[model samples]
Target chain A: MKVVVQEALFDPWEEVRNYQQQNLPRGKHGGSVIFVGTMRDFNEGVDGISRMYLDHYPGMTEKHIERVCEDAMNEWDIMDAYVVHRVGEINPDEPIVLVAVWSRHRAMAFDACRFIINDLKHRAPFWKREQRPEGEHWVEGNTADERAARIAS
Target chain B: MKVSVKYFANMRDRMGRADETVELDEGATVASLWAKVSDEPMPENTLIAVNMEYTNTEEALKDGDEVAFFPPVTGG
Candidate 1:
């Protein structure tokens, strides 16, 4: 299993290439799955989002993200996994985070990818501050995120 | 003792700076700093991370600590 975390402005493609490998599914080892999260321009009838502030609990963020990956490894025969999350400052249309997983079979890869991303959404010690054209506010946590996390628990 | 108080994102904007060195009375706790800084109206959306870990405003703080005060996170 592999996990990476960094702070970047906005570069989804570059970050994705970092973890993608040619030998992903060699002997059916090619069950590769990827998840990309993009920032939206508008929210809740609000005009639009200019930029967003991504914050993380420095110490806990890394550890918690790793734990999510470890959990996936335990249930499946996953070979490798990579999780990259950027922090600092990010704007709309930016790629905030990416989770890539590889396994000998497709099922494990897809399930692991979904599990990792879902867990991170709910449990990671990160918060967002949205800056819309009209004004700004802290993006409230969604019930969906909480419910998604509960399933894994 | 003097500790490094870091401000990130909007917190940095509202605090008008990213970091500062503050002198705390001996035995100062996290609550004490909140009581002191909360009055500044830096920003309502700000959260505190003490010693590189996210912490509630009421948590205790000690000397030689590195605290980062910033807005909520938006990461995958």
Candidate 2:
């Protein structure tokens, strides 16, 4: 599995291609599955969301993200996985994060990919600071997050 | 017991630096260190992480722990 924390912009399509290419050597057995998370324009019906600030609790965040990735690896017969999340500032239509999974079958890839995103949302030490027209708001974690994390506990 | 305080994104800009590793007393709690070191309101709203878990300043600490403070992450 490969996990990267960077401050550069990524083309979603390019990222998917890279993941597919990297694991293509195992194409005889594992089928590649890709998941891309993109930025949305609207926020609670509010207009003028020019950009979003990417901030994270560093030490805790990297560890938790890696843990979730490792769990995905162990639970499935996956060949490889990649998680790349961009931090700093991002504009609308930018790629926020990407998680790609590969396995011999689609089921394993799909389930494991979903689990990774869910776990990261719930357990990872990261928060969303959305910048909007009115002001900046600290996004709150949801019940689903708390629920997903209990699996680890 | 010293924990390095690092900030990312806008918090970095506000703090005028990216990373700050500070030394504290042998038995300083997160809350107490916050009051002693944090001079400005933490860029309006911020999140604190102790060790490798998202935590609050009320959480206690042990030696050799790394404390990080920053704004919430908006990345998907």
Candidate 3:
């Protein structure tokens, strides 16, 4: 498993290729699932977001992501998983994060990929501040209680 | 006891600094640390973590603990 927290933009295809080359043996995995999250021009039904500034705890962000990946690995029968999240300033339409999982069966790959992304959304310690034409605002979403409820049900 | 208090996102902006070493009483919990550091009222739904793990305000603190406080996360 590989977990990365960086500010540089990444090529999703190149990342997948590198992960497979370095971690997976040929014919060892039958299926791979990948998810890329990109910065959008709008959020929370508000449009015209010009850019986004992502902030994270330096020493803790990577560790939290690794823990989330480990949890997914333990819950599924996946061979390998990789997560890359970008921080700092990001323009609209740029990639923000990536999650990929390799498994011998498509079922495990799909399930594990979903689980990792969902868990990352709830568990990761990253914050976003949006710059707009009018002004800047911090985006607020589900609270911890709401997140716990969603996970429980 | 000296505890490292780190802020992120808007909290960092509001505090005008990223992090600082705060002096608190021994056996201080996360809540007391937050009250000591933040001048403004703690925002609703602010998240706290200790030593890289998610923690509640009531959790007891030890000397040299790294404490972080920030707003709710908004990442995908």
User: Best to worst by TM-score, what's the order?
Assistant: 3, 2, 1
TM-score of each: 0.68, 0.72, 0.92
* Residue-by-residue lDDT tens digits, candidate 2, A30-135: 5666677766656766678878776766546677788888888898878778888887777888888888887888889888888887766555655566788888
Task: Report fnat for all candidates as fractions from 0 to 1.
Answer: 0.45, 0.31, 0.71
> Order of all candidates by lDDT, from best down to worst?
3, 1, 2
Q: Each candidate's DockQ score against the native complex?
A: 0.32, 0.32, 0.70
lDDT of 2 by residue, B3-48 (tens): 7666665666667887766777767777777776667544446777
Error of 2 at A116 (Å): 1.0
Q: Could you tell me which 10 consecutive residues in candidate 2 chain B have the lowest summed lDDT?
A: B67-76
Scored by TM-score, the top model is: 3
Q: Name the lDDT value of residue A126 in candidate 3.
A: 83
Q: A132 in model 1: Cα distance from truth in Å? A: 3.9
In model 1, the runs with Cα more than 4 Å from the true position are A1-25, A28-30, A47-77, A86-94, A105-108, A122-143, A146-153, B40-47
Question: By the TM-score metric, which is better: model 1 or model 2?
Answer: 2
Worst 10 residues of 1 chain B by lDDT: B34-43
